[model samples]
Each structure stands twice: as C-alpha cells, then as structure tokens.
Target chain A: MVKAAQRMYYGKALAKLAERKEIVVLDADLGGSTRTSDFAKVAPERFIQIGIAEQNMIGVASGLAAAGKTVFASTFAVFATGRCWEQIRQAVAYPKLNVKIVATHCGISVGGDGASHQALEDIAIMRALPNMIVISPADANEAYAATMAIADLKGPCYMRMGRADFPLITSEGVKFEIGKAAVLRNGNDVTLIGTGQMVMSCIEAAGILEQNGISAEVINVSTIKPLDSETILASVSKTKCVVTAEEHSIIGGLGSAVAECLSENRPTPQIRVGVKDSFGESGDPGELMKKYGLTTDDVIKAAENVIGKKGKK
Target chain B: MGGAKGLDVKDLRRRADKIRMHVIEMTSEAGSGHPGGSLSSADLFAVLYFHVLRHDPKDPEWEGRDKFVLSKGHVAPVLYAALAESGYFPVDELLTLRKIGSRLQGHPVKGKPPGVEMSTGSLGQGLSMSCGLALAAKLDKKDTRVYCLLGDGELQSGQNWEAMMLASHYDLNNLTIFIDRNHLQIMGSTEKTMSIDPLAYKLRAFGLRVISIDGHDIKKIIKACEKARSSSSPTAIILNTVKGKGVSFMENNADFHGRSCKPDEKEKALKELTERMSSW
Candidate 1:
C-alpha cells in the first residue's frame, strides 16, 4: 500500500511536469512502472513513446533539446544508461545537450525482476561521462524536485530513482540545488555520506549511532558528480573518519567518488558500504539490500570501522 | 525567387570542381583519407554552402543558420575545402586537414569548426541528430531547415532506420536527407557486400518524400534540394553517384575509400582536375 502511495507521488510529479509546456516526457516503453503514464495522458503531444529503444530515445531527447524543448527521457536505469551509453556520451554529454534522463528501477531494490532489472553500475557509467550531472535522489519528494531542477539546468543529467518505495526523508519546501549536499544531521565524531536509497538508511543509522554516544554526521549527497566538495571536505576535515553508503557498486559509485575526494583534499580514514563487487539475486528488496551489505546496520558498522582506524592513526 | 536560378550556376560548378581537386590533394597529403565518398558528395556540399542553406560563414554559430551534418564523416576533405572556400577559415588551413592540432579533424568537430553543426564519424547517427535539430526547429517555430548526408554503406547501421522511423513519424518536413549512393564501400561494392537496393522505395515506405538523382550533376542535385524544401514531408534524396567522380583512376574504386594518392598519382590527379577546370 505504501508502494502504491509512492507510485501515486511519482504520478503526481509527472502531472506537474506535463503542465509545463516546455517539459517533454519520453519513455523507453516502461511508462507504467515509471509512472509517466499520467504525464502521457495529460500531454500526449509532448510525450514520445519510443518503444524499447534506449539509444534512440537518448538521441531523440538530445534532438528535442536542440529544438528548445526541455525533455525528460525515462526507462529502467540498467537499460537507459548501459544500453545507450555511447549515444549519451556522444549525443548528450559530449554536446552538453540539456536532456534529463529519469532512470527508474535503480539498485538492488528492484526486487523479483532480479539482477537483470537492478542497475548497480548506472552511477559508475553516468559519473564517468564528462558533462553529465549524476543525481540519485533518496525519496519520491527528492525525485520530484530533482526532475524539476534538472529540467531548468542547461546541461545533460542522469536522475537515478528506485523501483521499490522509499520513505520520505526530507520535508516539503526543502530547497534542492544541483551540486549542493543536504546535511541532514550534524556530528563531530564520524561523517556518513550517502546517496539514493542509502540516504534514508544513513539517517536511521545516525540515530542508532547517537544512542551509542557516537555523533555521526549524516549527509545526503543527491548530486554525485559536481559533488559537494566543500561540504565533504569540511566534514572529513573535522570528523577525520568517513563512511559512504550507496545502493551501487563499491568500485566507482558514490563511495569511490568520496574516497577520491578525501584522498586528494584531506586524508581521512574511510570505509565504503555498498554492493561488494557482485551481482544481485532474486529476493525481496529489503532482504536483498541486507544480504548485499547495503542496510542501515552496514552503514553503522562501516562508521565504527573507519572511526577505529581514525583513532589508531 | 527566379533570381536564385540566376545566381551563378557556372561558379557553383567551378567551386564543386575545386572541392574535388582539394579532396584529392588533401587525401594525398594525409597519406590516408576518404576521397571516394568526398568526391561523390562534393556537389551537394557546394549547393548547401553556396546557394541552398541559410548559413553565415563568418558566424558559424548564427542560431538562425540552417544546420548541415556530414554523417559519412570520413569525407572530411570535401567539407574542409567547402568551409575554407566559403571563408569560414583561411584556404591554407585546408592543408592542415588531418594534422594533429588542426581544428579540421579527419572527421568534422561541431562548434570547433565553422559550418559543421554536429561532429560525426560513427555513421547512422547524423540522421538521428539531424532529426533532433529539425524537430527542435519545428518546436521553436523557426523556419530553419536541417540537412544530413549519409553514405549508402553507412545505411548498414540500424540506428539510421530508428532515426528514419522517428523522422517520418514526426513528419519532419523541415529535415532533408541526402544519401551519397555511390554503391561502393571500403570492402567492395555495396550490393556485393550488403544490398541496400530498392533504397528509394525503402525510404518511401518509411514515409519520406524520396527522390533519386545524379549526386555529381550540380543541376539535378540543386533541383532535388529545392524540391525537398518544397515538400510537406521529410525528404530523402538518393544521389546515384560514382565513388570517385572526378579522378579517372580513382573512379568507382573502393581502395580510394581511405587510401591516399601517391605523389606521382597526386600530380596526375591535379593535372586532370586543372584541365577539367580550364575546359569548364
């Protein structure tokens, strides 16, 4: 029922986007799950139903952008980024086209549909591109704001959203900027930087850490690329220990980006909690997240481990 | 409008001949370049730059200017010659065609080089990009048209069909596609390798206003372009052309697809081009 509510929220967001005449919605045949059906009904003329062709959808969006239309191209994160990577690189990122890619069903949360549906490498692939802003919003509200913000932005961006329902963490009317990080909770002992679905997990973990007398600074890093370097650097400088959580690969996702930033700007003890260089399997979203060490407990454990290492140093 | 017909067809022909000559020289200088496709599309480029397209050579980024995307990008020599002759850059810059630091890369680079709307070499993509540009112009209510040139061999890519379906579905009357149907590719003849036959019919079936003409004949090429501009639907003009139209030895030769002419061969090619120019 909560999942149904989340879908309703996405549908409402799509409806709001459709009301804006410049907003054009494109679907790679996954309009139902993506909740783009609402927008399609409201503005069929603005909606382009590109059937199962991810690469062409990206190119078409890039074309639409050239025509002065703000386009939102949606599909499963796996197919949208992986299948049409070259087109994104050439037509969108290389040309710096103003096209917002709304990639749904990201991470191991895309349950039952299994590893094939889950997108663990979407962040890695999108972040590697030159002029692409990668955003993995935490909840339906963040997704809504991210969609609207990216539309107004002048360059290409990839918005990663989850399939399963995520709890609404941030309150309504909260200002969301493209490159700024949201500091959810403040602490001095250890910094917990998280993105996407993991932001809610980190927030919960920060509460648990508080009970144990560890002041854990929880930062919701929505924008992965053009990262909030100022916030990350300041937090790491004060905390001296950092834990990055994400529903993505440990190799090149938010964790790697944070590690790279810390290693360069400030040398801090860091532990990355994510899907360990492995594929997800068929299971419930919660069970799969826990099994793959992507739960709130994992973030807590990672924070403790990094803090221990920081104390030794 | 009748005065456009009087706008120096002879001078346009001479420019096309010079572009063909430049393609031979540049390809020979680089020791590697596509001369065949370049020669075939020379007249099309001449018409686009000289008379047809509303492009300002001085301000390449003039937003009101019509867009031209060379999908078959290996034929950069022809584009370089035309851009240089049209005063986008100095004529001497043509010699730096494929040099390391040259803005004129082996393929066109958009925004960096004047007159090039999209940077393309990976085939089957230009048509899609052009479709976007045309679709964008339509959305903006701009009267500017988007033109894309594709090689017959490049048609082997599936992306072209995807773009074709979209172009037709949108009824992008502002977009005009020219296929340099020279029938020769790097390996061999297009038919011997992969038949793109009934090409005109296939385009028509995809809901395009299809036209067939001699790609090298300036008169027919110009006429087809004018007809494409007048059509209510997107146009796909198939230019039945020789791989290398000007050079006798290189004509219909697949080896000229990416091979450079030898020093002695360059002299012979230049001499032939000069004689043809004098006669004209």
Candidate 2:
C-alpha cells in the first residue's frame, strides 16, 4: 500500500501535474486549498489564478483548449460544479472542448466548512450532463495518475478529490485507465463497489468481513460516469448480492450509478452505503464520515444486511 | 495593407445593406428573431467577415483562424447571413433560419456552423468564452485575435464584468469586444429597462482601450476593429446604433427588439432597406 502523507493528497497531485509541459492549471481564487499554489510558484505561465470568478475561469480554460492548450481548471467542487454548471455545459461539454475540471474539497470530507463547501451532490450534477467524464480518484497516487491520463484525453472531464489527507491505496506502478474499474479483493459471497475515498473504507471492510467468514469482493470504480459495467455486472452476477459505497449522496452518485447498472444488466440484491438524504454539518473529517455512515464499519454492516437478505430469499 | 487600402468601400456598404435586408426577411419568415439588435450589428458583422477576420470558410477549424463570438446572440440573424454569404453554407439556406433541425439554430451552435467559435445564447457568457479563446492564443504565442460582440442590455448581467476583470488583468491585447448599444431591449429603451450609459467609462476603468462609434457606419466600424487590433491592452468598442436602422417606422423602436415582421411589414421593411442601400 502507498503511504498517506500529512498534506492533502490533491496538493501532491497538482504538484506532480505541474511537471508536465502539456498540463495547464487554472484556479478561480481557491488556490490555497486546491493545491494549485505550488504549480503557480513553479511555472507561473502554466498556472492561471482567475481570482473568485468561477465562470470566467471555466471560459478561460475552454479558450485555452481551443488554442490547443490542455487546461485543468481547479476549484472547490461546490463552485466548480454548482456555480459554473452552465459554463461547463456550454463552453466545455456541449462543444466537446478539452478542459479538465479538477474539483477539490469534494464530499463531506471538506470538514468544518459546513454543507456549502462540501459538494455531496456534485457527482449527480456533473454526471447528468452529456459528454462529461466524471472521475473520483481514491488517493494521491491515483489522483496524480488520473490527472496525467486526463490531460492527454481530448474531451471535457471532471476530477473530484478531497480537502483532507486520504489513505494511499495503490503504488505508482499500478496502471490506471479512465473507464475501467479496479478490483482489490477476490471473493464470491458478495460484491462491494466503492469510489473516491470510500474505496479505502471498502478495503478495510473487506478485511473485517473475512474475519467474520463472509468472503467479499471489493471493486474500486474511479470513473463514475462512463462506469465499467462489464466488470460490475460480472461480479454481481456471480455474487448475486452487492454493497455500494461512496462519500457522495446516495442519489445519482457512485451508488446510484452501480444500482442503475445492476438493475438493467443483472438483477442483484444491493445495499447502498452513503450519506442518507441529508446535509453535512461542521466537524472533523473522520467524525463526519462516521456520522454520515461513510465508515468501514458502515460498509461492513451494509454488506452483512445485503448477504442476510440474500439468505432470506 | 495594399489589399485593404485598395478594397471598394461602396461594395462593402452594399454587402452590409444586403445582409440587413436578409436579416429582416428571414426574421419575418421565422416569426421570431431580434431584428432591432440584428440590424444594429449589420455593419460590424459585415466588416469582420469581409475585411478584418482572418479565416477560411472552407477550413473553419484552421489552427490560426481568428475567432468571433456574438455575445449578443439574440442578433444571430446578422451572423447567420454573414456566415452563409461568406460561403460557410449555401446562401439559399438563409430562409431556414429557425426551422427545426436546421444547422442554423436560433442561437449559434459551434461545429454545426462553420466560423462559429462557441455555442452562445445565454447572455454575459460569450465575453468569458472569448477571453478563454484569446488567453489560449496568447499562451500558444499565436498571432490570432478574438473579437466578441455584446448587447448593451446584456451588460446588466454580472458575468460580463467578471470577464472584463480577467481580460484586463491578463492584458489580453489579442481580445476585442464590441458593445451593440442600440439603446433598446425587449421591454423598452435600455435606460428605462437597465441603464448602461456610462459604458465607455466602465470599460476604460476595467483597463480596456475603449472606442465609441456610429455602429451603422461601415467605415467607422472597420476603423474601430483596426484600432482595437493595434491597441496594447484589450479593446472595447461601444457602437452607438439606432435599433432597426434601415427599416422605416422600426428605427429606434423597441417593439422590433424580437418581434417578427408581418407579411406586409416584411415587404415594406425590405423596400425601405433597399432604398437605404441606394444612398450608400
């Protein structure tokens, strides 16, 4: 397992992206947290700090793409997806412009800033738009790799990350693809599909379930929009029971995407583990994750419930 | 320089008049379009397509092509006429202005229409997109320029100011914006609806090179485009124009802001515009 650093993982990812010549980073005044400050310091021309204007920032990124410049517009997930949604839809997605939107402080993990800063519904908002590729990297290594991969891609993409430090699950050598799912464990009793920070929680839950003698397979689905349906369907068809986890809301996020896939392709008993229909409040990241039922224990409980339902059937 | 100096001003003025006539006729056929703004912007559109903009209609996506965005997208009739006449599409397709499934949507849709840089209809957003295009050009060290035409009424939207702030901050000398100050929106006169009178001062304060001109004067519009290209900072031209300039009774009338001309009204409007063309 890759080791978790003290600073936010997104910051490290941005720093690594700055090294590439093709990558151009843009920030709408939230440079301090989104970790674009490091890129600005190193390569000033490559970094654009469009202070406090999310709409203009998105437009600038789109323009850069038109001139054959690969641009990454970074901001809080709330502002990037919510405030500037129309700009994203018109300038980037509809035109099929190649602009990478990196949204940090995603989900409730953006602790103490309250519900406004925490973007629980960003996934739903972005995924609904046509021609948009939605991705949530599990850790710093994955974020770095995803950032690099998306820079080379030729269309609009949304990259979601967290404000706080997250556990680094995979090492540098692990191959990362845009629309493919990553399988972490092998089991047949039930399948657990998770994304973003929740992938780590699923890894922990898989270990816990093994102790209880319930074999569980865990899949880390990074790209939420163009979901790897074949992998997900194959796992659920064999297991016949599933537990989906994400830091996003149960509505239209990773869990919803998984359910949509399963209901259509392969019908399976499923339990979705995420924030119930509610808002997040001020607290530590760990406390908020636990309170919102986004912990490893929550996943274990959700998995057990799905398995129990299967036994009853 | 020799090509521009030797160009026939009379022929260009005739072309602008033809575009205005088409703008009225097509809007009348569609039964819905902003003729007031479209007629007001006729000269500027004519100058850009005929002289100022460096583009090949055959190769719309050419890497070094200069970009133009109609921020005042309600005036799409003028743009469509220019694009169609410039050989981007068949000139006969002008009658299909707002027809269902036509490439020419009510607002500009990029990729559907050659020479269209971005899909723009929502007000105050085009300037932002233009800034992006200009900034990209600057980054790539490409000499290509970006011109955006904004409605005076659209200045009421806050996003335009956001774009203004960034354009000045970046010193995007490659970007130029034209404000079609026709003084009429859908409701009434711009002052009564939403005042943007001190438009030049606002643009100047935002650090752009501001030029106020007679919008319908093709020569003045051409000179302003040339001046904007020569300016060190990003430029903003306020084209003081009367809404529906050539058509009698519709001139300076707010009712024509988006109302289609009746069958009889279309004949009268066309006759008036053709007569106005004879004077040039």
Candidate 3:
C-alpha cells in the first residue's frame, strides 16, 4: 500500500490555496517540517515566518482574521495546541475569528521527539473550548480536503495531522465536511470508531474481525468536537456495542466524545483503545504505536472485548 | 471631536476628565474593576477617540477605521468610557460595568459592542494581534493604522518580547504601541516585581522607534502618535503615568489598581475630577 503523510497533503493544499488573496499563512519556525514552507514558497508575501513563538503566532493569526483575512497558523501539535491554548481561547475562539490552526506531528507516533513533542492531549484541550471546531483527518487525502474546507468556513478551527506517513485509506480527492463522520464499513456484531491515524487501525481491525465470523462496523470520526452523534448512535444502536481507537489519551479524546454521546442517547458497552494516562518516550513510530496499544490488533481486541461485554449485558 | 483641525487640547483634556469620572462611576457602581491603570491612560484614550483614530461611532466596522487593541485589558473601564463618550453606545450603559449580562465585561469583548476590536485581558497578546492587524492592512494595501495599549507589568510575559521581535522583523510601520508605565501591578510596583527598566533602549534595540512621554499630556500623546505614523517602522510610546492620575486619594495607590472606590472615596474622586474639569 502506498502511504502518505497528512502534512505533505496539507502543504499541497496550502500551495494551491495561495492564490486566494484573503488567505494568510503563518508558521512558527517549523515551516519545513510542518509543510507550510510549501505555502511560503508559492506566496512569499502572504506567508509569515513567526520564528518559534507559538503564542504570538496565534495572536497574529487572530488579528489577521479580524481584518477580514482567512488566516492559517501551522506548527507542531504540541506547540500549536498546548503552548498557546489561552491565546486561541481569547483571541480566536472567543471572538469567533476565522483562523484555521493546522497542526502537524500529533500523537505518540511523532517518534523520537519523546513526551514533550508528542501531543496526545491536543484533541482533549482543543475540544473543551467553546466555538472551536476540532478535526483530525484519517489520511493524507482527507487532510488536504479538510484544509480546503476549513479555509472556506468562517470561524476558528483546530485541525491536527500526524507526522509519519500512513497507508492511504481514503481515495484521492476525498471530500470533507465539518461535523460529519464517514462510515467506512458496515456490520452488526460490533462498532469500531476511530479518528485521525487510528482510523486506519480500525479498518484493519474490521478486516480481521470479519475473518473470525464477527461483524464489525468501521467509522472514521474526523471531527472530534462536533461529534457526528447521529451516525454514531445509528451504528451503536444496530451493533449494541462499540470500540473507539485513537492515537491519543483515552481521556477527553474521541473515545470520551463517543462515550458522552452514547451515554446520553443509548448507553452501550464500549472499550477504548489509546494511550492510558502515560507519556510517550523516544522510539521508532511502529514500535511506539505497538508499545502504546495503538495497533490494529489492539483495536481488534477492544472490539472483541466490547462484544463480549455486550453478550454479558 | 475635530479630526482635521488644530488639536483641541482643552476639549481633549476635559474629555479625559469626563472619562476618568466615568471610570470611577462605573467601577464604583459595579463594586469592583480596575481603576488605577484606567485613570492613567484616560488622556490617551480621549485623544484617540476624539481626534487621532479615524472611527465613526455609527459604523465601528467601517473598513477604513484605525483599529485599537487594549492588551492590558483589565483596564477596560477606560476603553468602555471612551467608546461610550464617543457615542459608540449610550453613556448610561457605562454604569453597568461587570454586572451580570452587561455588554461591558470586566475585560473588553470584541463582538459585544461595535467598537471593541479584539477581546483581550491576557497580557502580552494585544501587541502580537496589533502586528497582525498592521500586516493585514499592508497586505491589502489599505492605509489602516493599528494601535495597542500595554501595561508595564505585562512586559514580564515572554510573549510580548516575541511580538516586539516580530513587529520589528516585518517593519510594521502602521502599528503603534503605548505602554502605560504606571509602575504598578496587582501585587506591587513593576520595577520591584520584575524590572523591565532600561525599557526605551530595549525597545529601540528590538527595532522600534521609541517615544517616551507623559501619558497624561493629551498634546504630547497626539504629537507622539503623529510622529509615530511618520516613521518607517513600528513605534512604541512609553507613557510615564501615575497609577491614579486624577483622584488625589487614589494617586500612586496599588490598592486602586484592582479595587473600586467606597462611597466616601467615590465622592472625593468625583469632586476632584469635577474641580479639575471646571479649572480646565
């Protein structure tokens, strides 16, 4: 399978979006790694090099948005969400400014950078802010589509992407809509929900579950904040049990969102596959994913666990 | 309120006094708010609202109007007063400061009133946002100017230095920042808390055209703004001001920095401001 990093496609999208006169891109000294360097190359004048100040980068983005420019601020996920969360809350989300905070190098898979660089809590914190739309694309194609979609939308958004290349699950030129989840596969025994890179794991988990005479529904929950409760409830209602997978903490990520939704609508037996209240260490991406229980086998086991809980109930 | 004519120093002075009176009234009426910094920056706000800023109270969202960001947003009573007295809203609404459901939040909110440019209270952020506004104006080829007011105590936040570096790097000629050097923070004096002294030279070293002035001098504030606009880079005006300028009892008092006046103190403050108004 040909794999692609979501950040590369985000850069491609920025390069294409450079022609829009109102689009202003800002990067905090990591343009090359975050792929905003591509936008800088095309629209040198529109691209602002913020030089390692993530807080100032967000404030500048807010100001630009206030003046009627659609601003895109890019940085590593740790710096993008954690380093300057208050700036986004006050300047961007509070005023409902049109700033798209696109962060790369999210999750434990940002290998070798260790815990400080990995942003397992980006989804949690960004989701907590009012008027902030949180999105985590499943693959490169969806990342590109999400980048374009957020630019057209007129409010503050936080969209995260992973660092390493992953299998291309969605086809090229995939369409993305805010607050909408896509159903990748359908079944009745159990529902497997995932977001960001973990969506790939869920798809693979579904494949293995099918071979074992177990039916598993696979869902790609791209927008984590405005969770697509309708699609989620529909799948859970039919399957009666659900498993959520994400390359983030089990606390306040996609699993929490799904749990919150299901508990209110239809309480179902569920298991979460993610990092368990622990920080990551420097290692290879594959090994780190395995160590953190973010692999396809982990998702498969979670699905089975939830299905077992369902039978017991 | 003359924009094209000679500077109305007397009218602006009276406006500053009236703004100070409103600050006292609003905070006292609400029983809590920032008054010391607000009193210090009244003259600058008066001059900006009455003369310097090209803003219409009727159309705050007009594309051509110059933008203002109060980075030291705890002093929002002054901004609300300036906006109200300038006819952005009814003057009576100024009395509702910090009350539940009042549009006049203890800190400024962007969308609540038409004139408030950005929601700000967290320090060191307004300058960066001002840089963004200035950059956006330049990119659009609009001659819009951006103004930001910061607190001296706020310089302790590392983000302000980052914004200063950025504003200088981009050569944001259309941006002007005012530092309300009232010398006090919530705890105590800024110098004792964290020395941002040798501040003018430091700002100049950061690539800004630095101007130091008595913040209470309406004429000097206006002139400094004009001089700032003539420069080819971002200008920073350090306004040397007493913590509480107009009211005698509150002058240089750190307690007034975050406190409203009691009944006796409010009466005295109003009388002092009114006496000054009559003298002007």
Worst 10 residues of 3 chain B by lDDT: B1-10
Order of models, best DockQ first: 3, 2, 1
Better of 1 and 2 by TM-score: 2
**Candidate 1 residue pairs in backbone clash:** A63-B132, A67-B136
Model 1, residue A70: what's the lDDT? 83
Write model 1 residue lDDT over A188-278, tens digit each, in one string: 9999999987988899999999999999999999999989999999887889999999999998999999988988888888999999999
Q: What are the runs in model 3 whose C-alpha is more than 4 Å off?
A: A311-313
lDDT by residue for model 3 over B117-199, one digit each (tens)?
A: 99999888999899999999999999999999999999999999999999999999999999999999989988899999999
Task: Estimate TM-scores for all models.
Answer: 0.92, 0.95, 0.98
Clashing pairs in 2: A63-B132
Candidate 2: segments with Cα more than 4 A from true spot: A1-22, A311-313, B1-5
Ranking by TM-score: 3, 2, 1
Model 2 C-alpha lDDT per residue in residues B1-280, reported as the tens digit of each score: 1114345778778888899998988898898988888988888887888888888888888776888998877788899998887888888888898999888789888777777778888888899889888887777788988999999999999889999999999899999999989888888988999898788888889999999998877788888888888899999999998888888788989999888899999999899888878987
Model 3 docking tier (incorrect/acceptable/medium/high):
high
Encode model 1's per-residue lDDT on B1-280: one tens digit a residue.
1114456777878888898888988888888888888988888888878888787777877778888888888898998898888888888878887889888788887765777777678777888788878877876689988889999999998888988888888889999999999999999989989999889888988999999988878888889888998999999999999988888998999988888899999999889888877777
Per-residue lDDT of candidate 2, residues A156-241 (tens digit): 99989888777789886556799999889989998999998899999999999999998999999999979999999888877889
Strongest candidate by DockQ: 3
Query: How many pairs of residues collide in each model?
Result: 2, 1, 0
Give the whole-model CA lDDT for all candidates, comma-separated: 0.85, 0.86, 0.93
C-alpha root-mean-square deviation, candidate 3: 1.1
DockQ metric for all predictions: 0.58, 0.75, 0.91
